[model samples]
Target chain A: MLIQRLAIIGVGLIGGSLARALKRANAVGEVIGCGRNINNLQQAVELGVIDRYDTNPAQAVTEADMIVVAVPLGTIASVFAAIRDNLSAQAIITDVGSAKATVVADARQHLGNYLPRFVPGHPIAGTEKSGVAASFAELFEQHRVILTPLQETDPQAVATVSTMWTQTGAEVIEMSVTHHDEVLAATSHLPHILAYSLVDTLAKMAERTEIFRFAAGGFRDFTRIASSDPQMWHDICLANQQAILQILDSFKTDLTQLITAIQQNDSQYIATVFSRAKSARDKFCG
Target chain B: MLIQRLAIIGVGLIGGSLARALKRANAVGEVIGCGRNINNLQQAVELGVIDRYDTNPAQAVTEADMIVVAVPLGTIASVFAAIRDNLSAQAIITDVGSAKATVVADARQHLGNYLPRFVPGHPIAGTEKSGVAASFAELFEQHRVILTPLQETDPQAVATVSTMWTQTGAEVIEMSVTHHDEVLAATSHLPHILAYSLVDTLAKMAERTEIFRFAAGGFRDFTRIASSDPQMWHDICLANQQAILQILDSFKTDLTQLITAIQQNDSQYIATVFSRAKSARDKFCG
Candidate 1:
């Protein structure tokens, strides 16, 4: 009921799931799926994620009133460039990239006149899986959708994008692109980096075989994100390099201090760190 | 059927759960729960985890055919020193400590001749919650139980401990105490350390109030172990300091390399790391 013509570029998990959710909610008129993979487009159509499919990003944009680019962070610039001229004069464009600063900057660079309607957005929801087959309408339900709009971005476009996400059951919040990058670096980017690093270190150890077998539930749960799309995480780390590095430095400083306390048998210091961490986890995580 | 006159020290989660499992399997004739906490002992008896209770560790060990020391790792030495003269001459002693080498060495220092029967064992299963109230009979069902016996450990005593654990539906395996520490440094200790560190960092951030509200499923799953018993993790980190530090150093090196790859825009290196980690996770964790 809210959107008339909706085009989803790179119809993978996020795009396909959004398409399905729009159909389920009856929030959009016509849904179009666009991607480089012809098979994925056909599969999306067969799966009814979209009413139709198109391999041409520009052609797909021309037939839509709104476009949602759901691709890896590194590819957002190219996708925007490809469809910038084709998007309807009044069409609102958004993205589901993990990093917003780089993507916003890329949109500004690629689409000069269209910058006001390029409402950069990120849905804080994902699984350790990818592709159209992994999508579901409820994927965005109860999730956070952060919109990072430049000062030049039109308020009207931002409201439309925010309302669209709200229709899909997401809570929308506005944030500066830089702050979004830093906040997510601590909350999301750093955790994935640690998971991949730990797994890589364990693999290099001589006890890798037995270590893997005995990993059990805790290790499995802790490292679950390491199984995510490698290309996607790689793009995220690169796009948000400075912020992720800052967080990693902070993490190392804290870890080293805790290690030193243990080495010196500083039970009081250890207890304080442990107690504070426990209280925070209980309060925030619960 | 596999044990007799079993004495369980500490009468908390692991201890109470073991007693409950033994009773359910009818593997022991008389089960005794010992702890400084009088209420915990009464509660354990009320919950049918123990046939009887003892406030004094020595009195609890006097008639036991086997003794299972399930106190915190930091208290293992003092517990052994207190019960050294009370343990039955033919009794086989084992512990359910996370760190094996330190506990085994402490037992050796205090129990001397009885050290050969003091086989160190670790049940690789636990919940984030603690205490007698959170325990259950099937806590160790189909779980891995690793026995780290010293070179001078009695083969017969090792067999007895293995049989007891097997009766509780745990698959018992043998490993060197040093190897056990190193492997667990990666599998359990490091994961916990990272979780605690991440939670602490996020809770102290400027946007914590807002971020905590929007923390979706991924953040919740990643930090689930951060809610574990802080005292328990503190003991584990301190007891396994050397191995844990080594693993932390290894993880830091791997993370530094990843950071460098991201900074330099080395997509190939980043992609390779991700692919290898993804494959390793799929093969080992899935």
Candidate 2:
């Protein structure tokens, strides 16, 4: 077995899916799920996602060879604090958060001498759905899992985590925590924020009902991300504040230039911007 | 037959699709496609989207009972002017443009006495693909078609256009030209501008390839519209400048509040905005 005992400290989609994948692959001898929601943990156990369940983080990590924290960004610090003293000295710790820099900083504060074992990770995959019921073994197939290891991180720990993710069908790549946070802030976090803002602005209009009724396919596709979990996004925004703000500033400047072009009836300028955006999007995402 | 001879200017997706739908329903005796590009018009005829093709709008509308102008918003005035003197007195004219107020104003300037026979329309349907090859008979099935009739428009002409759209399987609704422009600015124009701006900004980053590679499903869905036709969107932005600028200003205010909330780490404020957006999007576009 890759790990004798695997502890996942949040029996939601990410954590539950990982547990299910590991169990199916026979990568772990035992799987333990820990979370604040007893009902969700119980459901994970009943669904065979975990061998057992625990509400206490310290108890859960007592003998775990690997510990994965899959909670919201706001709770990462507390999760680290709870398991700091009880975690086995040899256990490799990791997390599946959207933002990595904040998680690495929190780990530095809580893990102390055990910091080298903590690797901040983010899996670039998910649906809008959440909870254990939404978990599936194939969710990470062909997806990327980025690991942001600290300067003092042990190579063996990183290798073990990387192997475990590979077993679950994910390609793992290593990068600095700051760079991870910056890239994700631009690609994921800022899009969610913009979607939310657009939806909120349109919903507040006097002609909202009719406006939505006539919204074309383009509008529907563009605002689909606005339906994601609010509390989760709220925590992400705070955790990746600096990176998010920088991208937001850049986006605002581009938007303002577009506004000027439109106001001046500068068709050539407007066409240039849209053409570049279309070619780039097609090249990268088509 | 609803129309004895139907002339369609600009046989691209919208014009070609309308002709195909009309032909499928046997609603028109003969359909004629007109455009500056002879090759596209020839392609439309070969696809059986039109019975014949012509490069001159005036010649195409000589004996036409109904004329549909489906060119880009930037060319509406020129198209109207081209056919104005040759249009039969009994012929009814209409256009499928994204912005209505500008088209209506242009019609007043070009159509003169023919204004009473003109109706403005927008079919809320399309794929990212364009041109004759992308046109299909069922493109407008279950889609909405909004008609903004001028004050002096003949009720009989409005009824005729509504019946034609209904025959094409589209639900037709009526509103003022100004109201149509304002509503579409909020729902469509602003979103397109935002998508183009975000994609352009991200594509210019030093780590752009990696950023695009790791973008999750949400980012892909949120920026799909950025791959739309640049010249078409440029025309739309300029055609509806006033309404677009107004909505953009409002969106800027909402975005500024969100930025401030993120900077202050005001989780409650962020949650409220995101929750409202999620619920609103679910209710409207779910």
Candidate 3:
């Protein structure tokens, strides 16, 4: 087994799925799920996603060989602080957070001596759904897991976390924390903000019900991310604010150019932009 | 059979799918596929999406009892002009265009004596894939077909068109052309523009390859519409320019508020906007 005892803080979709995937792969000896929600932790155990459950992070990580912090961005520091004094020296800590810079900063601030063993990570896979009930063993299969290990972090710790993610059927790629935040801001965070904003704008209008009633498959797919958990998104927005704002500004400039082009009936401009975008998306996106 | 001979202009996804659906329901006699591409039309006939093929709209519509003009918005006027003189007196003409105002105007300009028999329609359905190869008999099943009949248009024409759509298992909803365009701008056209712009913006960035490499399922779904036909969206943007620009402006205002909220770390404001959007999307969207 790659892991003798694994402590998974925040037994939600990502954490639970990781545990389940590891168990299915026979790479983990024991998985102990810990969270604020005792019922969810218990459910994770009952579902066999974890070997046991703990309501306290300190108690959960007491004898664990590794800890997976899968909590929302807002709670990263607190979860880190609570588990700091209890972690074993060899215990490699990694996260499944969407944002990396703040998460690594949280480790530095609250992980104490264990900061060297902390590897900030993000699994580039999830549904709009949440909680242990939404967790699946194949969630990370064929998906990418990005690791943004700090310079002070132990190389062995990074390798352990990468191996663990690989056992869960994810392809692990390492990059700097700044690059992770910026790229995710452009690809994930910005589109989410646009979707939420678009849905809210339409819903607040005079003909909202009618507008939504007649919405086609395109609109449904476009706004699907708007159905994601708001509190989680709230934390993400705050954690990744600068990068998101930068990309948002870039998008705004582009959108303004489109507005002017359409107003001026510049079909060639619209076509070129759209054609380039289509070719790029077709080439890059699955 | 409700139609003695059904003529499908621009026998691509929507048109070919409609023909397939009607044939599956046994609602039409002879199906004639017409488009500029002789190869695609020949393939449609070979695939049984249509009984025969014609390269000219005028020749294709001769003696046809029902006609579906499924060409792009930019070519609606030309297609209507081409088929106007060849339409039988009893023939009912309808379009499957996205924007109804320009389509109604196109009919009025070109259909002449056939104006009363013209019905403006949009079967709120599609996939990113196009052509007869992508068409299916169930493309419109359980979907909505919106018809915007003009004042000078015959109710019998609308009824017949509605029944034909019903035969394809679509629920027909009728509204004024103005309301349809405005609502569609918010729900459909504006989202397409944003997706195209977002994808184009990211693809233009210095780290485009790495950014796309780390993009998750959320990004994939959010930008799925970006992979749609560029020429179709180009036509849509120009045809529905005014309404699209208006909703886009509203969306921009809301987006600005979000930017301000994120920059200022106004957590409550961001939470409120995101929460409302989630709730509305959960309620109104499928």
- lDDT for position B77 in model 1: 93
Give, for candidate 2 chain A, the lowest lDDT window spanning 10 residues.
A258-267
Which portions of model 2 show Cα errors greater than 4 Å?
none
Residue-by-residue lDDT tens digits, candidate 2, A1-286: 8999999999898998998888888898999999988888888889999989889999999889999999999999999999999988789999999998888889989988889998888889988778999999998888999998888999999999999999999999999888888999899999999999999998888878988988888888899888888988999999999999999999988888888888888888899899999998999989
**Model 1 DockQ, alpha carbons vs. true complex:** 0.72
By the DockQ metric, which is better: model 1 or model 3? 3
The lDDT of model 2 is 0.91
Query: Which segments of model 3 are wrong by more than 4 Å?
Result: none
Which parts of model 1 have CA positions greater than 4 angstroms off?
none
Question: What is the Cα-based lDDT of residue B274 in candidate 3?
Answer: 94
lDDT score, candidate 3, position A56: 84
Q: Report the lDDT tens digits of candidate 1 across residue range B128-201.
A: 88888988999999899999988899999999999999888999999999999998998999999888888887
Q: What lDDT is reached at residue B103 by model 3?
A: 86
| lDDT of each residue in A1-286, candidate 1, tens digit only | 7889999998999998888888888889999888888888899989999888788889898768789999888889999889987878889999999998889889979987999988999999989999999999999888889999889899999999999888888889888898888888888888888888878888878768889989978888889998999999999989998998898888888887887887898888877777777898789777
TM-score between model 2 and native: 0.97
Interface RMSD of each: 1.3, 0.9, 0.8
The positional error of residue B115 in candidate 2, measured at the CA in angstroms, is 1.3
For every model shown, the clashing-pair count is: 2, 0, 0
Per-residue alpha-carbon lDDT of model 3 for A1-286, expressed as tens digits?
Answer: 7999999999998998999999999999989988887788778888999989888899999889999998999999999999999888778899999998888888888988888999889999988888999999999999999999887989999999999999989999988999989999998899899999999999899888888988888888899999998999999999998899899999999999999999999989999999999998999985
The global C-alpha lDDT for each of the candidates, from Candidate 1 onward, is: 0.88, 0.91, 0.91
- TM, every model: 0.97, 0.97, 0.98
